[model samples]
Target: MRWSAAALAAGQILVGGPVAAAPTVVIIALLAVVGLGVAVADRRLNTAVAWRQVSAVLMAVDLLATLGLVLAGLLQGNDELWVLLVLVVLAAALRYRIRGALAVALGAGLANGLLELLVNGGEPGPVIVGRLLVLLVVGGFAGSIARELDVERRLYQRMAEASQDIVAKRDEDAILGALARHVKDALDGSRATVHRYTLAGWEEVQLPDVLSVGSADGGPPLLTDEEGGVSATLHRLTWQQGSGRQPNRLTLPIRLPERPAEYVVAVEVTGPRPSALAEGALLALAESSAVSLATRDLIRHQEASNRRLERLEALRTRFVATVAHDLRSPLTTVKGVARILRGRREQVAPEQVDAMLASVERQANRLNRLADDLLDAARLDSDALELKLTDVAIDDILRSVVDDAGDEVELLGTPGLVVEADGPRLERVVWNLVTNALKYGRPPVHLCAETDGDQLTISVRDHGRGLGPEQVENLFQDFAGSGDPDSVGLGLAIVWELVEAHGGRVEYRPADPGADFVISIPRERTPGGSDR
Candidate 1:
């Protein structure tokens, strides 16, 4: 506004010759200086509180200047001075659009027409009427264009704000919902719905339907129903904007950069077809939402990885403590017994010495059992456990584990039960189960085995505190124990893994007073074995 006004002022001064009207030149210069100073102040302060007031005051100045120009031109007989008035009207149209055009147009038109009649005391000529008409036409035309520019400016501002809002969000679903909400706000829509692309097709994600949940697959394939990829998707969006067919539902595809297309953010508009700008906003929102999703997905994966690391750390800590505690008891017994026998050999009786040696043997066996379990568990964890199957007598394996049926423990099974099996591993399984029964259960422990056709079934039963219905589902999973601090919980876990390796399975039965663990393996004999 200032620059144009200054140029016009310079031209008028030159046309009328320098010093034609010093007062008029000073007034135009003062207006430019004042306008430029106020505009710069407003920008620096970053405030528009007094903008309306300042605009009104400036319009008032414009009017006063126009009347002054009219009088100055008449007095100097310089008719080109009217151009300054035309510049003011044109400036108003570009600046204030609607109201600016109206005020400046009214002011300039009246100054040319009515002021001429009052000053010259007669009818205004064709020049005055023509200037008035021109000002009005320019004002009306530029005002409409200015209004459109303002609308576009405000729309772009809103899109930017919405983009900022979703960028700060952490969850992918929340990001989609926020974008959908803003897109719905831009249009006349009730509520926006976010859909996750799935193999089953577009599935609603918000307040998710768990029973019929959607997974990330080909998101809203309707976009890519045609041959092309992104082009077809965009073409579909354009069609929806103008396609009277699916006017009620508008879907926009959201995709990650340098990756496959992801999900869709959709809005259901109740009113007429959305304007092009509204659709453009939705498209912008889709892009912003896609970026938010990618960011959130990265953060989510990082969090999951951190949690897994933490769990692994805890597991290692627990495992080390358990191993130390479990082996210490047997080691202490073995060491104490050996020391007593060595130091008091002459004082001890023959039977007492034999008993002490047997006790030492039992403790040594317990230590060895723990060591085997630890090694087996490590092998199972690494997926390296293997079986050495042979034609072996099952009855011999079970009987060898416990020849003397003590008062509390009993072994019951068929005689000469033979099958293709790993004899030592089979013995280890029986020993672990029996030891577990003695340590954990209120025995009356029974280790039973039978053969039904070609399938051999072996069961260990005891009356004890057993698992409840809701206790644990993954009973065979490692570390799933009864929380007994003295016992390492890998007994049952190793039992299950070892059984599975033998083409067999282990099952637990919830009895009334205790629990029963049953193992079943193939009962086939080795083809080339002697029938001894």
Candidate 2:
């Protein structure tokens, strides 16, 4: 009912005589009438059909209103009436469907030309016709351009929606498959496949293939010939009528670090040539996918490493338990024999007693050293070695180690050398080095100490056969030895561990005739000390 009233009002005003009312009032009346009709019709029609019909009717109404106003002004001898016609035409072209609106504009233009002839009392001239033609052309062109813009906008919206769907999928295979399908649709390709290359080779995956299979067989060549290079190549191929072969093919290589060539992707397509924009977008997608594949591979490798480390830890626990159990029996026997020998020392025969006591002492010392090394290694592995730090003279510690070993070490120029260290551990380090020199060095082992600024240096020189470069490289490594049948190979390893704990470093150099092992530690300030 309201629409009927509005339409009647608009029709009455359009047919009414000329007056001084504003031109805008006429435009608003026409728009209200057209908009009301459209709203009513839309309730009974499908949305697309309703929009088209309403747009057509509104454009016609706008054209008739423009003609009526133009005719009224011409009849009244108004010269500025063409401006009203232009506004109506532009508004109609902008607001309505292109095809029907352009048709209405043509009809209105013809009516206006005829009205002009009638008002001027003759047929219209070429000047009037040309003016009408220009208006029609401008309006039609604007409408067509707007329609084309609308079509492009809709297409972009659809592509965006499809891309969003692909990105939201959790499964990689599904995502890749969707991406390939989107590419095929966008490029109008007959078929599209994504191939990944790894160190082993390349593999073809279905649109959604996510199982990570490798391509080792003579599959089609990679897009780029250069090793580890990523690029895209397009080729045109012959296709038989019913052979289901694609006529145009495109291959793209996806590269990521530390991944096999098979994991990289080569997108294959067969159809008409793809545009540069389409190809660029496809390459971008492939590169992103390659990064994701590389990330997944790294995660897998780290998980494997963690599992291996757990297994190694278990084995180490078992080995330590076994070693501890084996050493207990020997320790018990040595302790028992030592006690017996000590209690009957006066009553025992000299030769028999001497031999028995020597055997007991040797075995006891061996057991003690083995136990100490095992504990120390365990502490190091667990990162549980704590240091009791103190300032001690390096020369004093060396002298004490030599005294404990009961070996004569030839002293070179003595230097007052003090170092910040744990006394017991430092003593152990010096003793191990001196003992190693005594055991392996030719007679007359040399012990020397010197200090320079913040560093204290100590060296044990031996005249034994020198170690080779390879042996020296691994000399301080645990369980590494001089290849001697009688040596257990733990002395230098222990020396290294203890010296490192005291913030010192050790090096072995082949002396002129034998070997020289040197240790350097940070020197501490000595209080009330004289050169010794």
Candidate 3:
């Protein structure tokens, strides 16, 4: 429009004659120069504020320049300069829609006709009337086309923005949130919400008002279908609340392949409802959002898989190093003790020989425990460790595991406390706890248990330095634990897996003097295989 307006004026200037007023020619040339300069200088005018300002300025310039040329009598023999008025009208329409264009058209036509008549000494001729009619008609037609084009432009721009937002979000919640915000803005609504139908109820992006599904108000439900499978539909809602606002609703059901109409986007506004262009945009947004959300899910799943693989690789490397060091230390001790015993049987006294043998036995026991933990871990990894779900006394498991820790370990719990579990697996869980307490803890390690309703609570507490916050956090992770010399790091991991298999959880309970490891197993749940 800017170039066209400038070209029409330049054509008048080039058709040289006295009728082509030199001042008029200079003004048109100046308008073109200024238009070209603005176009070149304001390259970053992508925002609404900048574009609107530029359009207003250009429209004003075109109208004033056209009037100046007509007043100067430069266009007396030619009405070609009138084409510049059409461009001015179109520019007004682009800036402020059809009303703006019609305004410019009427104002320019009357101003030009009045000026021409005054210049020609009050002649009400056919030429002036015809020009006014041409101006009004051209302005009205151009305004209509501009309005339609503007609507289509806005729709495309909004859709593209929504699509970009969807693709940029990395998670489902973010995608849904982005979709809701963009949908609301696109539809020019007060509130917009995305709802996903679930078995429990309808879950929405924004917490719905009291009018959500299943409320006692018994107002019109959000979902039209009784089975919660409605397709795309729009409805008008009457609210009992609000002071002066009349709220309307636009519901669009987004259906994915092989899925029912489970996800819906609802937009509510106070004033006017969305136009057909906005409705079309909403539908396109829904369809594109579904595909983009699915693609986002696939991307997230792949990222999670990659993270798991990286973790497994790290665990394998750490496990190999830790197992080798634990096993080698114990075996080397046993070997050194045996060599000493073989060489000094005659020189050593019976008491001294017995002490040496006990040292060898302790190292051998350490090696055996390491081997057992490794085997249990491998069984857990292979999903081959089945549980023997039977009625077992929880108190018995606690006392037995504590007693196996020797005299220093104390048992404190209720009697005849029973639960349904794999006795051996439950015993290994207790055994690992006791082993951990004995190895890293002070004397008087306490094992306690209690049955409360349907849950069995067992705790093995250590009165030593216990563990730091960091150690406590990773206490139950593979190859991760407190930096105790005797810890192979698999004891608590195995204990956690076994307890979880029995439908229980183990946690590091904060104790005043030390740290407490508590395992809570539900007695009502049937035992299952371990998960490490």
For residues 281-388, could you state the per-residue lDDT of candidate 1 as single tens digits?
Answer: 667767888888888888889999999798667767777887787678778877887898889889989998888787667777667777888888888778777767
Please say which candidate is ahead in TM-score: 2 or 3.
3
Global lDDT of model 1: 0.70
**CA RMSD (A), model 1:** 6.1
Please give the CA lDDT of all the candidate structures.
Answer: 0.70, 0.61, 0.70
TM-score of each: 0.78, 0.41, 0.57
Ranking by lDDT: 3, 1, 2
Off by over 4 Å in 3: 1-100, 107-134, 147-186, 205-247, 252-264, 270-325, 348-362, 386-434, 441-488, 495-532
lDDT of 2: 0.61
Best by TM-score: 1
- Model 3 clashing residue pairs (backbone): none
Per-residue CA lDDT of candidate 3, range 1-532, in tens?
A: 5566456555556664566657567666668766775776478677878777776776677788767665654345554455566767767776677788788988888877787667656775887678778877877787888887787787779788888877777776676667766776675656666677778866654544412433344343444334455333322221222234334656776656455656677666555655666666766776677787778778888999999899778667776777788788878878887888889788889998887787777677566666766787899899887666788987777766654467778888887888888887788788888877777777678888887677889888878776777877778887675765444478888988888878789998766666788889987764443433
